[model samples]
Target: MRATTTLFSLSLLLAVSARNTYRSVLTDCLNTASVPILLTSTTGWADEIEPYNLRFTPAPSVVAIPRTQAEVQSAVKCAHANKIRVSVKGGGHSYGAYGLSGTLVLDMAEFQTVNLDQTTKIATVGAGVRLGNMANKLFSLGKRGVPHGTCEGVGIGGHATLGGFGLDSRLWGLTVDTISSVTAVLANGTAVTASASQNKELFWALRGAGPGFAVVTSFKLKTFAAPAVNINWSYTYSFPTPAAAATAFQIAQTWGQQSAPKELGYGIMLFPGNAFIVRGVYYGAKAKYDALIAPLLAKLKTAHGGVEPTKSVKTLGWIDSLTDLAGAALATPARGYDAHDTFYAKSIVTAESAPLSFEALTALFTYLYTVVPPSSAQWMIIANLYGGPGSVINSLPASTDPSSTSSYAHRTAGYVFQLYAYTANSLPPFDADIIPLVEGMVTAMGEEAADLPAYAPYADPELGQAEAQVRYWGDGVARLKVIKAQVDPMGILYNPQGF
Candidate 1:
C-alpha cells in the first residue's frame, strides 16, 4: 500500500512539474514577443480583462494587445505554439463576453485604420474599428457607409461575422454581405486574404462564423452611397392590456410579411404598460415614408378600435441619422471600454414564410407582461423587420442579388426579435428573474413553432453548446464544423457557442 501511494505521489509531482514547465515556456515566449502582453500577474491585467457585459467574468490567463498585423501574427503564433486557446477582443461589446474567453486574449484595440477608396467606394476597415467610428469615417471620406448594428461600440470583427443587422440591412443587406475580402491570421500563424475568389472556402466560413476560424486583421468592404436624404419616423400606441398589444404586434407581423418595403427599415419597440413604438428610418422623402407607413396605421386603427398613435418624423443627412439611432453610445474608446450593462439580451429570427401567429404572439407578450416578469427590473422587446417583399436579406446564396454564398443562414429572417432585460445602471445585483423572463419569451413562441431558431449574433450564454449550435447555425452546422476543422484544427480561436 505504501509503494502504491509513493507511485501516485510521484505521478502527481511529475504532472505539476510538466505544467509548470509548460507555463514557464509560454511566459518566456509571450514576454519576449514584439507586442504588449499582459500576464494575469501583471499590473493592470484586472482592468484590461474587464468584460463589457458585467454579468460575464471570463478569466483569461494572458492578454495580448496587438497593434500591427505582425504583432497579431506574433501573438497568435505564441498562443498556437503553447497550445493555448486564443480569443480576440475587438471593440469588446460581446453580449456573451466571448471576446475575453479562452486562455489568451488578442485585444485588437490598436488596429484602428479606416481607408476608403473614393473611386471604387471600397472601404478597408481595421477589424478593431468600432461601427460608429467606421460609419463616421466612411461618410466623411466619401458619401459611403456599410450596413451595421446600432451600437457604435460594437467592433466589426464579431458583429459582421455574426450577421450584423441594422435598420438599413433590409435595403442594403447585412454587414457580412458587404465584405469584399478579409486579411486574417490563420491558426498556424500565417496571414492571408480570404475573399470570394481568394481562399474562397475560408471567406465563406468567415462571413457568418468567423470567431471560430482566424484572427481577422482588416476587412475590405463594398460600401454603398450614403443616402442624400434620410428620414427618421416613429409612432407610439397604447393598449389596455398586453394581449391587446400582442394584437397590434400580430398586425405588425402581417404587415412586415406582406408589405414592408426594402427602402424602409423599422422596429416595433415594446415598453412597459403595453406601450409600443413603431420607429425606423426610410431611405427617402417624408411623404413617401408616410405613404408607405399609412397601411400599418390604418390596419391598427381597424383592429379592436385601436386609436391613431402619436407620430414623430424628422429628415436628416447621413451622419446625423446614425447619431440619432445610436444616441450617445457611439463613442467607443480604443483601449478599455467604459460603457457596460448588467443585462441579458437575446434574439430570435422568424422566417418570412412563417410569421408569428397571433396565438403565439399573445402567449409571448402575455407571459412577459403578466406572469413572469416582475417590477424589480427593466425589460424591452423590439421586433425589427428584416424581410418582406424586396428585402436584400431574403436574397439566398448563389442568387444574383449580390448575396454571395457565405455561411450566414438567416436570409429568410422576416422579423428579428430582440429581447432585453437589464438594470438601469452598469452595476449588478442583477435581477434573478431577468434571464428566465427573457428566455421564456422565446420559449413561449417556440412552443407554438418548435423549429424556430435563435439569432447567432445576440448569443445567449445560458444555452448548452449543442442547443446553441442547432439554434444559431441550423442546417449549416456540419459544413461549418468541416471548415472549422480545416482552418482551426487546434481549436484555438473559440467562443462558447462557436463552431
Candidate 2:
C-alpha cells in the first residue's frame, strides 16, 4: 500500500540518513536556481514560524525566501527535478501540516508587494503578502477589498484558496469572487496563469482547492472605493437550552434575509455558554442600519434582559477596520507550544440538519473545553449565510470549496458552519489528550450532524478510511481525484489533502 511505503521510507530516512537529508536537499535546490536563498538552521527560523494554533510545526528542512514570480517558478522546478516535495508557505499561518510538513518550503516572506490599479480598480498582490498588509496598502490608495475574515496575518494565497469568509462575505462576497487572476507554479514545475480566458479549469480548481495543487505567485483582485469609516457593534446574550439557541439563531438569519441591506453584514456565534453573540457591520447611515436591526433587537430585549439596544461604535479608515477586527493590539504572537487544526465543517442550512447540528455543537464545545487548557484554548464556531449579491458564491459558479458542491448527493442550501479550535499547549501524549475529546464528540453526534463539506486546507490524515473520506467530501472527492490525476499525475506535490 502507498501508506505502507510512505511509512517505510520515513523510517529508513530517519534511521540511515537523518542528519543531512534536509540540508542536502535545500543546498541542491538552491544551487540549481543559482540564486541567493535564506537558510535558517536554528532559533531564528523557529521563532518567526508561528501557526494560528500550536499543534503544527514547520518542517525541519531549510526554507527559501522568493521575491519574484520567476524565483518561485525556479524553486518549484528545481524541487520537482530533484524529487523533493514542495510546499508554498504564505505567512505560515495555516494550522496544519500543509504549511509545515516535509520537503522544501517555498517561503513567500519576500513576496510582499501590493500594486494597485486605480484606473481599473484592480490590485495585484504578491502571494506572500498578508491580508493585513494588503488592507493597509489599499487604504493608502483609498480603496477597499471584499471580505476575507479578521486575521491580520493570513496571506491571500491560503485564505483565497480556501474560499475566504469574512465580514464582507455577507455583502461584497468571499475573497475568491473578487479574484481576477492567479499566477501559480504547478506540480510539474511549470508556471501558469489562470483566469476566465486562460486555463479556466485550473482557475476554477485554484480558487478553493487549497495551495498544494499549485503555488500561487501573485493574485489579481478587484477593489472598491474605500469606506471612510465602517461601523460595527455586537450584542451577546445567554440562552437556557440548545433549542432556544437554535431558534434565536434562526430568527437572526430570517431577519438578515428580510431587512439587512447589501452594505450591511453580520455574524451569529452560538457558544456553549448558552450564549449567542450577534455582531454586525454597517457601510451606510447609522440610523438606516439601526432601523433595519430594530426588530431583532426588540425580540432579544424581550427574551434576554442582558440584551441592550445601546451600541458602541468606532469609526476608522478601511485598513483600521481590519486591524480592529484582528484584535491585534490585544493578541500577541504565541510561543513555546504546538498547535493543529481540524474542522467539523458543514455547508448546508437545511431545517432537518440544523437542529441536530445545534445540539451537537453544545457537546463538541463542552468536550473541547474539558481537554484544551483555557489560557491556551481559543475556538471559533462561525455560522454565516451566503446567498445575497454580497455572498461569496453569488458571482462565481458553484464548486468553490467554501461554496456549494453540486457533486454532493446530499443537497446544500447555501450556508456555512465552521468549527475552529485553537490551543497553545503541547502536552505529553498529545493524541491521547485531544483525539478522544474530538472523536468522542463526533461519536456522540452520530449520523444526524451533517452540514459541512471537505476541507481542502485543513486535511486530516488520521481519517483516511472510506467512510471518513465520504463524510468529509462526499462526491467532491471523486471530482478532486480526477483533477489531481490530470494536474499531478506523478504525485510529486504530495500532501494529506491533495491528489
Candidate 3:
C-alpha cells in the first residue's frame, strides 16, 4: 500500500513538471519571436487584455500585439507550436466578449490604417479600423462612403464577416457586399490573399465565417460617392396604455410593408417610457422627402387618435449626418468601445412572411414597462427596417446574395429585432432574472415569426451550440463545416459558437 501511494505521488509530480515545462517553453518562444508579447506581468497587459464588454474578463495565457502582417504570422506560429488556442480581437465590440478567452489573445489595435484609392474608389482598411473612423476618413478624403453599422466602435473584421447591417443597408447593401478582397493568415501561420477568383472557397468563407477560419489582416473594400446631402427626420409618440402601443405598432407594421423609395431608411424604437418613436432618413431634397413621408404622417396621426409626434427634420452634410445619427455617443473615446459596462443583447431577423403578431407585440411592450427594473442602466427594443422592396439587397437573387456563399443566411429578412438589457453594476439576480426575460422576448418573437433564425453577428452565447449553429447558418452549416475542416483541420481558430 505504501509503495502504491509513492508511485501515485511520483506520477502527479511528473504531470506537474510536464505542464510547467510546456508553459515555460511557450513563454520563451513568444518572448523571443519577431513580435513583442505582453505577459500577465507586463505593465500594459491589463489595458491590452481589457475587452469592450466588461462582462467577460478572461485571463489568457499571453496577449500578442502585432504591428504588421509578418508579426501576426510570427505570433500565430508561436501559439501553434505550443499547442495553445488563439482568439483574435479587432475592435473588441463583441457584447459577449468572443474576442477574448483563456487562450492566447492576438490584439490588433496597433494595425489600424485606412487608405483610399480615388481612381478606383477602393479603400484598403486594416482589420482593427472601426466603422466610424473609416467613414470619417473616407468623407474627409473624397466624400466617399461604405455601408457600415451605426455603432462606430464595431470592428470591420467581425462586422463585415458576420453580415454587417446598418442604417443605409437598404440603399447600398451590407459591408461584406462591398468587400473586394481580403488578406488573412491561415491556421498554419501561412498568409494568403483571397478574392472571387483566387482561393475561391476561402473567399466565400471569409465573407461571413471569417473569425472561425483565419486571422484577417486587412480588407480591400469597394466604396461609393457619399450623398450630396442627407436629411434626418424623427417623430416620437407617447402611448398611455398597451393597447395604444399595439395600435401604433400595427400602423407602423403596415407602413413598413409598403414599397417606399430606395433612398429612404426607417425604423421604430420602443423606449422604457412607453414611447414609440418613428425615425427615418432621406438622401434627397426636402421636397421629395416631404412627398414620400406625407402618407406615413397622415396614417400615424389617424391611428394615434389625436396623439401627435413631436416632429423634427434637419439637413446636413454627409459627415454631420453620420454625427447626428450617432449623437453624443461619438465623442466618447474609442467611440465608447472601452466603456466598462455589462449588458445582454440578442437579435433576430424577421421575414415579411411572418410578421410580429399583435398579441406578441402587446405582451412585449407590457413586459418592458412592468417587469424590467427602472434602475437598469439601459433597456430598449430596436427594430430596423431592411430588405424593403426595390432595395439593392432585395433585388439580388438568392443565389447571388452574400449569404449564398457565406454562412450569413438571413438575406430575406425585412426587419431585425434587437432586445437589449444593460446594467452598470453587478447586482445579484441580474443575469438570473434579466437573461430569461430577454430570452423569453426572443422566443416570443420566434413564435410570432414562424421560428425564424437569429442574426449571426449578434453572437448570443446563451443560445446553445446546436441552436446557434442552426440560427446562424441554417442550410449552410454543412458547407461551412466542410470548409472549416479543410482549412483548419486541427481546429486552431475558435470561439464559443464558432465553427
Candidate 4:
C-alpha cells in the first residue's frame, strides 16, 4: 500500500510538471514581440524545425519567426522579462541542436533580405539570408563577395560569425574581415549597433565571438566590385602508392608556395579511395593564369596528364563562378546544400615542420580511409593555399579580437586546412566508426595538433567550452570575458562555449 501510494504521487507530479512546461513555453511564445508563434501541429512546423545537419531533433514548445530587427529585439526582451529560455535560429545549420533546444526558438529565416549600396559597395544583409541567395542576388547586381562555404544553404549568421573561408579568400579575405557593422539584440533586450568606431570592444568580440553574445539582427559588410573569374582546372588522382601520393601533395604545396599567384587559389584533397585531388580558381585573366600554373601541369604524370579549362566559359561572373565552385552549371541555378560545418584540423606543412609532415599527414589520411569507408558519403577536406593580395591576416595586431592563429601556420607565411566530415546517413557507423578515427588522428598528431587552433564556427562542441575559447578568442579570451560580464551579467544567453 505504501509503494502504491508513492508511485501514484510520482505519476501525478510528472503530469503536472509536463503541463506546466508546455503552458509556460506557449504563453511566453505567444507574447513575443512582433513575431509569429509556431505550435507543434502547425503546417510546415516540422520542416521549420529541422536543423542543418539533421543530427538532432528540437524540443521547443513553440517557435517564433521574427520578420525584423525590432521583432528580434522585442523577442529577446520578452523572453528575459518572462524568465524563459530563448534560442536564435537563422539557417538551421548548426550541429548539436544549438538554436532549437530552448523554450522558445526565435526563427529569423523570415528575415532574409539583401540591401546593397552600389555607390559605396556595401551590403546590409538580413541575418537569415543564406549564402546561395546572397551570392546569387549580389551576382545579379554585378558584384560578388569572398564567396561562402561550398554548401549552399549555410546561413550567414553561423558562417560569418565563425570566420568564413572560400575560393576568393586568398585574394580578398575571410568573410568576417569585410564586416563593417552589426545590429544585435543583447541579453537585457536592448538593441545596439557595433562597429569599429562605436562600442569598439564589442565590435571586436562580435567578429568571431558574436553568436555567444547576442542575436544578430542584421550586418553591414564592405562589398567588392564583381569581376570575371577563371576556374582553370579540376583534377583527381588515385595513387596506388601512399608515398607517391604524399610526394605529389608535398610537390603541390611547394609549387603553390613558389608560383601560385595571389589572384589564384589552389585546394588539395585526400580522398577515401587513396586519391589526391587538386582544384583551383584563377582570379586574373586566363592567359596569365595558365602561365602561372604551368608548374602544376608539369608535375602530373603522363598517365594523369592534361589541363581542362572551361573553353566556352573561359571567364565567369564572380557570383556565377562561386556557383560553379559548387559544381553547379549555369542553367540550373537552384542547386543548394544543407550543411553542418566544423573543422577538426591541425597545422599547415612548412619547412620547420617538414620533418614530421610526411608521417603525420599520411597516418591521418590512412586512418580516415580505415574508419570512414569509401562507401561512406557526406565529407571532403579543403586544403586552401593562403598568402596573396589579401594575405594580411597574419599581420593583424596580436590583440585583435579575431586574429588568425597557427593551426595552419605551417606555411612559412600561413594557410587554412579544413577537414570536411560529410555523412548523408545518420547511422551508428559515423559516431562509432568515423568520429573515433578523427579523434585518434588528432591524438596521434599530439603536440603538433595542439599547436593548431580550431575555427570557432567549425570547432567540435564535444571539446566543451574550454577548447572553444582557445580556438576563437585565443589570447583575447580575457577581453571577451570582460565584455560578456558587462553586456550579459546574468548570463541569460546560452553559450555553448561557456564564455
The best candidate in terms of TM-score: 1
Q: Which stretches of candidate 1 lie over 4 Å from their true place?
A: 1-21, 304-306, 372-375, 398-404
Residue lDDT tens for model 1, 1-499: 9999999999999997986676677668877876788887888887888877888788877788888898888888888898988898987888888999877888888889999997888999998899988998888898898999888889998898878998999899999998989999998889999988898888887888778688999999989999988998888888776678788888878887788788888888987666778888999987888788888889887664757778888899988898889986456677666778888988787887878888888787777667545446678888899888788888656221244557787877778888898876656867767888787777787565555678888888888898888888777778778888899898878777887
lDDT of 4 by residue, 1-499 (tens): 9999999999999997986775565566566444677777788777777765554667776778777777777777767766666777766766555667666788777767688887887888888887777887766765556445665676788777656677666566667777888898888888898887777777777777776677888888877766665664666776656555666666776666566666776777766666667787787787787777666767755324343322222466665677677665322211133333322233222232233366665666556556643335445565776553344343344444244321121123344565655444543233434455446656654566555655565646566687667665566777778988988776666656646
Runs off by more than 4 Å, candidate 3: 1-21, 329-337, 374-377, 397-405, 424-431, 444-446
Shift in Å, residue 8, candidate 1: 14
Given candidate 4, what's the lDDT at residue 53? 54
Model 4 deviation from the true structure expressed as Cα RMSD, one decimal place: 4.6
Say which prediction, candidate 1 or candidate 2, comes out ahead on lDDT: 1
In candidate 2 the C-alpha lDDT for residue 184 amounts to 84
Better model by TM-score, 1 or 2?
1
lDDT of 2 by residue, 248-289 (tens): 665676665455656776767755445578876777666776
**Model 4 poorest ten-residue lDDT run:** 404-413
Task: Tell me how far the alpha carbon of residue 290 in candidate 3 is from the true structure, in angstroms, after superposition.
Answer: 1.2
User: TM-score of each candidate?
Assistant: 0.93, 0.80, 0.91, 0.84
Q: Give candidates' CA RMSD values in order.
A: 3.2, 5.6, 3.4, 4.6
Candidate 1: deviation at residue 307, Å? 2.8
